[model samples]
Target chain A: MEKKKEMVKTKRAQKKDNKWTQNDKVFLYILIPILILFFVFNTLQLLKGFYYGLTNYKGYGDYSFVGLRNFIDLFSDARVGKSYVFTFKYAIVLTIIVNIISLILALGLNKEIKGKSVLRGIYFVPNILGGLVVGYIFSFIFTYILPAIGQMAGITFLQNSILASTKSAWIAIVIVGAWQGIAMNTIIYISGLQTVPEDVYEAGMIDGATGWEKFCKLTFPLILPFITINLVLCMKNALMVFDQIMSLTKGGPSQSTESISYLIYNNGMSGGQFGFQSANAFVFFVVIVIVSFLQMKFLGGKEEQL
Target chain B: MSENMEKVTKEAVEGAVTNENEGEAFAKKRRAKHKKQSGPVQGKTVNRVINILLALGCLTVLFPLYMTTIIAFKQPSEMTNDISGALGFPAEWKFENFTEAMRVTDFWHSLGNSILITGVTVALCILIHSLAGYVIGRKMIKLKAFKMSYYYIVSGMFVPFAVLMMPLVKQTAQIGIANRFGVIVLYTVFFMPMNVMLYTGYLKNIPTQLEEAAHVDGATAWQTFWKIIFFNMKPMHATVAILTAMSTWNDVMTPLVIMAGTDENTLPLAQLNFQSQFGTNYNLAFASYLLALLPILIFYIVCQKQILSGVVNGAVK
Candidate 1:
């Protein structure tokens, strides 16, 4: 151990001594090609996406530069507007519900429960299946099983599949999204809970704190960082939610369940309006960046204060 | 007894005589009570209630999966039959539904395409991400440009691929790369940011001694990295590989837009086609879902420990 530390120190010294060397050139040789490939394939394509948003480009053939025309149409496009609203609602609802429920599950598992591991594994099992498959599974449950059970038991609301209605479709999406996405947040919360030292809880107990009180005063504040990470992640996933929505509703009973990603997909790929869809895609990217940034700044600053 | 001894020893060391007698008596009562049952009666009841609730929640989560498996085995006619509730086991299990669905899906060709695409994507993803992560992390070149390039790639993670993909629809058409190999290339470049993040965090922790020792032995930089640094990166690489591989395997939109309506069918696309082909046979549809699910489920069951830890680590970043 001592020798390792000493050797690391000398390496640091060597770095300062030589600054840059002919030997250092080898790393650049490896780095440059990867950088070039990324720039051409991923980053350059993003730049092209931005450029296409300003033009009259279709899927192919001829095009002309129609400055700001696509962006102008974006304002009046009723479907695009509805999708943005739906995406926001889905993101907000799913993030809040999933985090709350996941926190509860994490706290429950942290307690003195018999078969804690078994219960946790079961809760996390859905996460192993893709969002696509889980959506299909629940589609059957909602359409065939739940309604049949409801009809057999004389429950009117349950007898009608939730996906058939707009209001209930929102809830159904949350249910499926929460099922597939909750496990990771729960795991993260468990890890965050474990980080709170035992002595901290002991001190709280010494002052006669109740369970809810300890959670409010100690656990929540300490776990704020984990909460932020999970929140941002859930928000992003909910915003991009495509596979599940496609499998569950196919944006139907009348295009009511179409998310923003689905909107871009249907417009660009199916509708053959490449340039116009690229404009919508550009706005979607900006909205995500802004929302995530604002969330991180607000919550992240609060985290430091705690 | 362990609890009692700990409390007694702590009190003795503190020299705090206040409540010392009460503490000892309480410890004895606790030890005696421990032999009869665990904890207070009220707390036990509360815990039992919580456990039962948790168990119910687990069942609720597993219900859909349970339904899929049960119905997948039932004959097509049994779906509407009234022998029992839909949740009940099939009276007549027609496993032939799976074989029929398999035939319609061109299961062999679709499975081959999925394997080839995912296999090549994961191999290339690991190669580039690790190679880049290593050089940038170790600062072997000691240049500001390399670090800037690192953040440049990391920035791609925030821009939703939904938007990035819009232009590719046209561009790939123009270039005529929207085939099986085309989607493979997209997955390769698309997944780099995440892989790099994981590898960078890992590579930063490694000590410089191994590389320096190799240097002293007259080893070339390639030889040292391939032989020494790569071994230490195995666990992180496995984490990255499993995660990216699963996403690529389950991917639907990519193959749908790029490779669909052609002979180059990925599993999800094939399953989608199967739904249309056997529109009325719910049995066959469920069978296809199961077949589509089986491969990834098996992989996950085998590598779950690595996967769970990978998720936590990747998110905690």
Candidate 2:
């Protein structure tokens, strides 16, 4: 009788296990198809970009592989040349200014002040607005507000325009980009700042450290990780910017302000040089991947200290 | 009774002797120090100065929007000659610019296209990404190897939309979904990483025990998820939905690149087209841009609290 009872219990447990296995199998069947669709589609989309880069193909059905011809043409293309210069210049300027301004805002809000949250809200409001809307508003500001300010300052030449010239157009783009990005970056920096323990600050103060000393030693060093994350992401994003430029400048004043992405877009879609755009895009992809990889590696090395 | 009372009094006297004098002096000095620190009715001067400076900076940031609002309402002559006058609240408010802009830009069709595309994109992205996010977040599932796939997807965020636009356009042409909801779906794929990150991060904090319990209580996996896990992820859902909506609704690039040569242009692209139509008409262009931004701004304002709270809360977590 005892043997039979044990056998029954074991069999029942086995049956439950079988039921679970069946349930899991059913779940997997339902999920795997969807997962594969997304994965396969996205992977193909990305990989095809690279594959198409090497081809001397047009939009139609037929094409042949042309090894590095697209790249060679890319280097020689005057439009691509202008875009490269403009994009790099804009990225550098925008990255540095945005970081500094956001960091400053973060530090300011980090202090024990009244209405700090409200101040934060006010600053971050622009970020919530769509980039296109922000671009549109900036267009008017460039056309209208800056001129008025210039007039008030008695600077007649500056009063005449804000974004007509190549140099001025670049400046306007950077300023608008910085404005749009500052709020989120400020929030990220603030998040970083909060990680500095109060006791650490007190300890610094106990050592007779001044405010600046405390910030430089305790705050800045501690926030390096956040800085890295913010910097890399910002740099990558600024490099790939399109909407605002397309809206505000449209690579205007003779394509003086056209970035790589904008150039790729205009050439491929409007100009119908599909394969040429693909090559430009592939180069952009490689550049992004390399830069991001290096950034990750550098940060990875510092992760030990963090 | 008298002898006991006398003994108690003596002990109390000794206790007072030991404790009172030092305590009294400490309290007196502390009170004196507090009094000295408390100056009569003065505010924090440093805070005031700092706040004033910050307010000024914030105003400068907002100055562009303020000026635009003014310009969108002004007359063409005002816009041309006196940019300042154009950039002020009209002395006599004219709402006709908005009407004129709508009529001139075929605003209805453009608005409808934007709504359809953005709505479809947000819905599909949320659905697909949440499923993927859930799979990644719920590691108890047998598909544990899929976490690497999620990481791969996350890295896709770094791929510039430009890099993919060319091939994406071509691929869309092949798939025959280029101009319509195809661009919308592709946008979802491209933009999924950020939304996935948000969802997965949120899901991590939720204990798996809830779903397990629901499962053990004879619920199917789907039921357990929808009934238990999904219901619990309100904050994450709000954040993702609002953000996805905002981005898709505002996106010009995808429509510009993919939807080109088609009549399926969204609001931002329509605005671009509007610019072409009335390129030289500064008033009409400005007015159209304002019209494009208004509905979005309204939506954002209405959802502002939820969006801000969701982000702030997510950050805290």
Candidate 3:
């Protein structure tokens, strides 16, 4: 160890004397290709997306720069407005539902319960499965199995497929989304709950604090960061929800569930409203950045208080 | 009798004092026993309630999976409109549903495609991202350019893929890689920012002295990296590989848009394409979904402990 430390010191001295070393060459060789790829795929695509937003370009040959025409159309376009609304509504509702259920599960799992590991494993199964497949499975459940059970039980609401009606379709989507979404959040919250030292609870015990008080005053404050992460992640994912929507409803029943992402893909790639959708995509991008920023600012501040 | 009782009480008190001073473990055991004797009746009931509730929650979580499995095995004739039809087991478990699913979806072909895509993307991500991370992580403090580049790449985290979907569709075709290969390249790039962040953050703990020692031994930069740095990054590799593999395996959009006209199909895309054609023949659809799910499911079941912890580690970053 001593020899190695001495050697490191000597090497640093030699490196300071040399203007261009073998390491510099290695750095450039590695960095240049990565940067080139990044520029081509990521940077170029972003610029092209922004530029295309200004053009009258279809997916094909010729186009003229229309200069914010697509942006102008975006505001008045009822479909765009509807998608934005749906996305926000879905994001907000799912975020709250998912976090609550996950926190509850996490709290339960954190206790010295029997078969806790097994229970956790089962809850986490949904996270590993693909969203599209889960959506399809749930689609069948909603379409057939629930109605069958409802008919058998004589329950009026369940007798009909909830997905068939636009009013209740989003509810079905939310059910499936929450089922799958809570797994990761629960895992995260469990991890956060585990971080609370046993001695802190012992301290609470000395103060004669009830379970609920202990959680609100001690556990809640400690895990606020994890909560922040879960909320931000859930909200972000909900906004970009595509796979489940694709499999379940395809943004259907008169496009009531058309998320911003679904709208972009449906119109931009296949609908040949490429240029117009590009403008919408740009706006969606800005919204996400702002939402993330706001979440960080708000939640991060709350975290700092404790 | 009174004198004997006094002696017994004094000895018991002394024993308790000694246990407190020198036998923490013994004291803990005694306290545990005391608590159990006093409170176990109510505690047991509460535990039972929690257990029942959790069991129900587990049932809800597993319900879709159970339905999928049963429906996959059922014969088409058995798939009636009633609850019994959906719930009842098959008289003879039809393994051929899987075979038919494979045939309809070209299961081997798509499975091979999914594996190839995931395998190659994971390999490239580890190889390329680690190198970039090493360079940027080590040199960013000294070089202003590296610092700028770090921020530049990390900023891509905020850019949603939807924004780039249209332009990339056109761009990939124009570049003549509107196929699996192109998708592979794009996946490598798509995952760059996050993976780089993970790797660079990880590299902070790996000391520079190891590299200096290798340099003193006349080893080249590449040699040092291949021999020392790569192996040191095993934990991060597990995190990155699992994350990349899961996403690449399950992803539907990239293949949908990029591999549109191509004959190649990832598992999700194949299942999707066959979905409408199967229509009411859900036995076949369920079978295909199971088959698509089988590989990842097996992978998860095996490495679940590692995967779960890795997810927590990755999410924090």
TM-score of chain B of each: 0.82, 0.79, 0.85
Please provide, for model 3 over B224-262, each residue's C-alpha lDDT reduced to its tens digit, 9 standing for 90 to 100.
888999999999999999889988998988899999989
Question: Taking the tens digit of each residue's C-alpha lDDT, what string does model 1 give over A1-306?
Answer: 677567657766777887675567888787888888788778787889989999888867788998999999998999999999888998898999999999999998877888877666667767767777678878877887778778878999988899999778878888899888888789888888887889988899889887799999988899889999899888888899999887888887677888999888887876868889999999888888899889888888878333
Between 1 and 3, whose TM-score is larger? 3
Q: How far out, in Å, is residue A167 in model 1?
A: 3.3
* lDDT (tens digit, per residue) of candidate 3 on A83-172: 999999999999999999999999888777877887788789889888888889999999999999899899999999999998999999
Candidate 3 chain B least-lDDT 10 residues: B1-10
Task: Give lDDT per model, in order.
Answer: 0.79, 0.73, 0.87
Instruction: DockQ for candidate 3, please give it.
Output: 0.60
DockQ of each: 0.51, 0.34, 0.60
What are the chain A TM-scores for all the models, listed individually? Answer: 0.92, 0.87, 0.94
What are the per-residue Cα lDDT tens digits for candidate 1 across B1-317? Answer: 22332343343334334345545655666577668755465455556556656765765665566567667788866767332545667786567878887898888788889899999999988887887888878772467877887788888888777988877766677788879878988887788888887888899778877887777667888788889988889888887887788789888888888775367798888877766666567777777788887787777667677777777777787
| Best first by lDDT, ranked | 3, 1, 2
What is the Å distance of residue B115 in model 1 from its true position? Answer: 2.8
- Expressed as tens digits, the lDDT of each residue in A144-255 for candidate 2 is 6678778888987678566898668888899888988787678878888888878987788679886589778888888887788778767887898888887788889779
Label model 1 with its docking quality class: medium
* Model 1 segments more than 4 A misplaced: A1-19, A304-306, B1-41, B81-85, B140-142
